[model samples]
Target: MIRLGLRLTLSGGREAAARLAVIAAAVALGVGLLLSTLAALNAVTTQNNRNAWLNTGAVTAEQEHAPSTADPLWWLLRADNFDGHLIGRIDLAATGPHAPIPPGIPRLPGPGEFYASPALGALLRTVPADQLADRYPGHQVGTIGDSALPGPDSLVIVIGRTPAQLSGDPEARHVTSIMTASPADCSGSNCRVGTNSNGMDLILSVVAAALIFPVLILIATATRLAATRREQRFAAMRLIGATPRQVSAVSAVESSVAAVIGVAFGFGLFYLVRPLLAQVDFTNTPFFLSDLSLNATDVLLIALGVPVGAAVSARLALRRVQISPLGVTRRVTPRPPRAYRVIPLVAGLLELAYFIGRRPADSGGQIRAFLPGIFLVLGGIVFAGPWLTMIGGRLMARRTHRPARLVAGRRLSDDPKAGFRAVSGLVLALCITSAAVGVINALTAEQGVPQGSASLSSTVIGDYRHYDDHGNQLDSAASPPEALLSALRATAGVQGLTVIHADPHPAPSDHLAGGLATCAQLATLPTAFGHCPAGAQTASVGPSFSVVGLDRLLSWPAVWPSAPATAAQLQNLPVDQIVVATDGSKSAIEQARTLLATAYPDQEQPFTIAEDRSQMSQRLSGYQQLADVVIAVSFPVAGCSLAVSVAGGLRDRKRPFSLLRLTGVQLGVLRRVVMLESAVPLLVVAAVAIGTGFLTAQLFLQAQFGYSLRAPGAEYYLIIGGGLVAALAVIGSTLPLLTRITGPEVARNE
Candidate 1:
């Protein structure tokens, strides 16, 4: 009896299986994405662990203070409110005539703790440009800085009870000082820099996972109906003698099998993408990571849960094996009260609420815009979808002059439910396509980021080489490259010329070696002009971009003409250092940086070149983020809707075609009506989808996400054309199916 029941149920499940296949594919897509996300998280955690173990001595209770006022090192070591040992002291002082900023000194070390300083960057510490900057920990030399802390004049101190006690200092340039941690706290990059590279991506991964479920549910909502349609043969067995329970069990089995297959496919996709994911290297950035964390838990969860969930979801989705009293009253009519009509009302209230509740507290502009746009879409779908179906049906009926055309029109009206489904699917497809195109356009647009109102166009700082008066090239090996500047200033077409050399932190190197890049806190006086004032004194900045170029006593920038150069960045530079390009052009920038370190062991330096955005357009042209799977699913669902529409148009002729073949009408005429009907709705739907898609695209991607929506100008129009062509193709594909004139099958064929 069970076997008989199983056969009966399986026979009735073709329709459900067909519908559920699409859902299964969508499920597979979700699983693939989930796998990738899990891998990324695992990579992050693994690297975090390795890093913690590698740099274990970074945490301490010393407060690791950077003397706020008047060299606090002296005050810190005074033994007034002390407990453990006093890690030495750090200070800066003018060591020569051209000493960077002859400010108060800040370097000292009571060796007992740990005196750690790097001799690498000391070469660039122009006593005249900066002192203590070369002394701080983890400071970048040439990156973003205001050239603070006189290098030659400033120094860092490291004093403690033991060598291990002064193992690592806060990246106060030069890693100036290190001291013991009473209790070791092996922390990750949160304590240092570069520990967490893809924090934002981690959040995005979770969101991506959440979005997957909704799309799957919507697409698969009708799967059961499909199964029932296809399994008529099996259902007949149940009518004869099979039990209902056995029938349901067979359904469960089929659903379970499909779900498992889908999950397996998803995992295959995940592993396929792993190699590509592993190739990314984000090391230079302070927040970079060469290795992403990968965890098995996430992958395993999806592998196991998705299959079970799919099976359960299928089981629950099918409400009953027993035919309802109403089911027995079964009507061939597919019409259901148009649930899509509420779309408009829901959308309206959402819009009304959007405008009323918005506030600055929510980061206005984009968020406010997102509100109304979303509501409008939902409303449009609900209201417009049903309306389009009714109207399309009515129009077909109204326009059909002949008996054949007339019959097709009324049939379409009678089947508005199916019509609505197809049109809605088309509209949805259009929305996604437009949104994706818009984002791609925004990302690949050739335009550099503007700095305030300044435009950075194609300006060149041509091959940089310097020459002397006698046409003899100056030696770039020994001293600061001053000769090159004089010659460049003399050259024509040189709209602006400003030479940047390395600025050093006066701090020691070891403490600086452990990550957190900026630690230089230079004291400055204001200038009259908006810029820094150049004088006997120097200016400095931390590794980060915040500007601190003035002391309280200096005149404001409005009153001064220039920003001061520290002694380190000016006319003076340490002698004897013939900076070599060690690593060569293969890594010209990195090689230059490394050479600087080898030559001057005790200062901070930057990457070889600063960012220049003269050709912004040229830089952003190659990225293509095409989500093909999504497009494939959407386009076909839309085509099926088109086929139903065409079929509706030929309903009266379904019998006529049967009669014509019996009497004498041509097959071609039947084919033509199918074509005409399909064309009409396709065009109508294409127009609606295109128009709505554009508006939705502009609203979400640009207005909401702050992406550019500039008329891809002509490109956008071309997109409209593409949409039309796509609609045509869908209609065309279904012509064969639509004209399947089965010689008047049962009387309902009409």
Candidate 2:
């Protein structure tokens, strides 16, 4: 039977060959996308393994008290007990001639020989060898290999000295030990390596898994469309005494052939694109082509899964047609989609309601609860799509008097499931685009625009420079000198001398008038507060703002002028200041900042400028990049699905369209009919999908982030409008095929 199927397919001539080729091409594209995605995942996994090997330390313990000997430190550094690899370190000294070595060194060095990690070695080389001994109080002998360190980027140095030689300052302390993985722990080739802890692997894995379903759907839809023309042939075979099972076998054979060809082509495609995929740096480091390759198991999965999946989909599509001795009966009119399809949607809404009613206090917890709700809502929308499409078709039929509309509407009403499936990819793309735009808008809505020339082009002062890696300012850090402040005040361009002092006490009341110098200054700023008393100190007080009344105050870093600053409430917090130039010129402001910086020769905290506009642009740019990625992945899938549907519809209607052409139907009318069939449903579905997405995003934003809903911007509308236009374009592209199928030659053939 399989041989017979193959023979028939080959001999079926040009049309059959063309159909097979189209099906194979579509399948290959889908398979290639999936394979590339998997390959990228493998690359990430490989990079993770490399990182794990480099980061040898697995566990760490901290001790407040210093140990008597360096033996415990060596144990911590080189310990290989069953309780995972251990490493820990404590400060050895502040500034002295004799100091204990830092962590990450493989072994204690002799008095004249000290070892450093590559990063530390680089730093040591920058300083003169004689100065290194005086400044670092250690003999910099050599650098340690990566194997002895936790990560290649680490900066560390080790010194060999007795406890008596170490500094006795209260802040001076030595690490008892900093351990690494024992050899046995990393012994076997099959041992699992550690992963990069950025959580991107899990996220990418989840996204890839989600994408698999849609890719498979596209593949199945493509194959089903390709086989629509072959249904009558299958029915005729059944009439000639072929069993239903035999008919299925024939389908399986045809599908398996196409799928095998496609999978092979897909592998070649993946190989071609592997280099491009290697350029994507999700972890800030580009992965090698070898890292992003398909292993043996991945190859086997594609080799077997694609063909089997295609064959199974073919069998399922053919199940709706009855095969008997007389002939096979194709069900032109499908049953109405069930209303019960909405149960999931309703249940999801109820779950959201339940969650909202509980009113979870923690915003993070609310977001976690909302994630499951999001999935449920998506499933509901997908399952309910056919029913919605049916209703839309009926409404369209009633509203229009044109023959094209009537015909297209009836067709959709009859097989809404097909119509729904055809537009499913498009609808999903639109929804996701709308949701992303809406959420981004809502999050950024509260940000105020910077006022006047107060842009980052000017110089400002803050405590940013004095802070160490741990965010604590160095003890020797001092306020900007009185001379620099006076010089800046006397500078020609200097304008707003706003000193944002750390308020030791702010009135706890939530009245704007009390925080402001007077109601007059408060009136100059945009405030949500209403009704103020005529006094410098009103009964109402919440947050304090500088009395300077600068409109460009929002440009300052980490400064929320209207909102209560928790940082300001801390006792003895350092004061920060912003110097805006009168001319509001970037060069002038920059010149002022330079002069201020020069005042403090050993400047720990340098002057800065708050360039709000550029910062906002950068933030929006990032959001746009994210949106572009989503659109790139989704739009093509949807467009292809629409194209496939049009092709399939034309195939199914070939005879009817030919008869219409023979009966004096104008070519333009026929074209209109085709356009209406694709265009009307798309317009209706896109509107519904976009609306749903926006509302879903609004609800999530309100519940999860407590952000006020903001209207989507012009770009959001443009994306949705573009999707509709693209759908129409895809439909139009199929018209040439319609002309070939609906010719008078087709009518005369039968």
Candidate 3:
């Protein structure tokens, strides 16, 4: 039976050859996409593993307070921003000669030396000493290797500090050994090395789900191409006294041949495109090419799974022929899809709506509540597609007046499930695209600057007060030394400067509003202080004295306070805040920030309004980039499935179309009929999928983020419009094949 199947598949004339070719091509495309997804996931895992050691396990308070030993190393990590980029700085101090060292470096550095990643070294060389290089407090002795860095573009530095310098810092930890994995209890700047945050993991889950579904559809659709013809042939073998098992074997052999061929070509395709895949920045940094590759196990699975799955799909599709050969020979039409097919979809929508209305408080709870709804919605689209297509077909048959429309409508009405099957992949793709685009739109739109907040883009604010872990005041400079103020004024971009004095005996209830400044001095920052209260002198200011409080104030919806104060009392106050207005240039801002860092090393870093907004935009862009890549990959796969289905449909109905052509029907009319048969069901389902996607997005946003729905951007429109046009183009390409397959030669009785 297997031999017979092989010979028939190989030399069963042009129709058989065409069928094999279409199935092979479709399977090949599906295989390639699946492999690419696997490669990308592997890259992410590889990145986390390589950088995990830096997260170094935290020591307990008891261990930290114990007697000093050379075996354990003391480490403190801080994040510093230069321009809009994040630079990781690790401060290390050794208590003895045997202190443990982290991966990818030689001996621990002495107090005056440091090590920098290659990217950071290049940056230090390019940027001025005052702006960036001087902030490190040491000379570079060596370059950190790739094993220690997450990506080629990562900026990291390891600075050597004395034991006394890190003594009282509560954030410091003593580590006897490096961690090989991310610690479960790790949080904040120290946890930046290996693990992804909860929000990032959610986005990745969404991307994976969106991509995998369409590829699965493509594979299933591929195995069923030319299914009608295969059924008749298999039924004939069943009628010839061949056992059912033998018939199944014959079918499997035929399907597996094409599948094995496709798997080989798919492997080739993945290797060819691996370099380009490496360029995609999933985590805001491009991965190394070596890291973006599949391992031995992944390769083995792909090799075995594709062919076996194809064979099984083919065998299952012939179940009707095996049970009763006469059913297929007599041309039986299957039962119409029932309304129950829509139950999952309706249930899913209701579930989502309920969850949205409830609005769970914690992130974990929200995710748990939303997962079932999300899964139901996805499953429902697939379940309800055929029923929706059937209803559309009945409406088309009832309403059309033209001859081509009449014929197309009746055919669709008869096999509405088949009509819907052709575009199922496309329906899923649009749903994912619409939902992703909608969420992205809301996130980006809501990131605009807060209202009533001052536009102090050119100003850098720094406070010179230091606090311990217990929030106890450690050191508070009454004023910046006169020499330091003179040096800052001479900086190239320094356009204006002012000082804010802290009230010596601030009331307990008004501690946050203790900073005092005269009207003339406050007027220099008209954009921020906003025309300083009319005729007021020495007004008390709000939390603009500290960088942390100022950042919060700018983003929150509150007015910047400027209540009048007595000059006599203000004069006795000490200087607490230094605000520098720069010339609104990047160079000037960096220069001013560098001066502040040099003056107050222990305080929180200074920042401008522009940097704050830029950081938010960068974070949002990462989400957008991920969605864009998924959409880009999905559309092409959907288009391929559409093309294969169109070709397969034409091959299956060749005899009927040929007879129609011979009975005085023009080829152009038949073309119109074929076009309607595919287009009507496709357009109808696409609309439903898109609407469902947008609704799901709205509910999800409201439930999880408390955000209102925002209109999608131009990119959303382009994706939808271009995808439909491309799908139509795929349908049109298969039209020429119609004239060839449905010619007068095809009208003869077998």
Candidate-wise lDDT, in order: 0.39, 0.57, 0.78
Tens-place lDDT digits, model 3, residues 148-172: 8888888899989888877656567
Runs in model 2 deviating more than 4 A are 40-202, 205-213, 277-298, 322-332, 357-372, 446-476, 480-625
Model 2, 1-750: lDDT tens digits are 899879766677777787778778878888887898788677656555543322222332223333424433221121010011111111222233332333335445654465766755774577433222222334666676654443444444554444444442222233443323332233332122333232333335334534554566667777787554567677777777788888899888888888888888988888888887777644434565677788889899989988898888888877654423233354446579988987886676566656644657653465456656666666677788888888888998899898888877887787777777777778777877777777778766644333323332343443212345475433322344556556666766565443333333444442332221223323322232222344322222222232222333332222223323332232134333333333454344544544543443223222333333333344344444455556666778778777877787787778889999888887778888888767666767667767877777777666655676688778777877787888888888888887888888887874
Each prediction's RMSD over C-alphas, in Å, is: 15.3, 10.3, 3.8
Rank order (by TM-score, best first): 3, 2, 1
Point out the higher-scoring one by TM-score: 2 or 3: 3
Highest lDDT: give the candidate number.
Answer: 3
* Most accurate candidate by TM-score: 3
* Candidate 2: Cα lDDT at 399: 90
Candidate 3: list runs displaced more than 4 Å: 57-70, 168-170, 183-204, 295-297, 357-366, 443-459, 463-478, 486-514, 517-521, 529-531, 545-578, 613-622, 748-750
Range of the 10 consecutive residues with the lowest summed lDDT in candidate 2: 78-87
lDDT for 652 (candidate 1) = 24
Error of 3 at 435 (Å): 1.9
Cα deviation of 201, candidate 2, in Å: 7.6
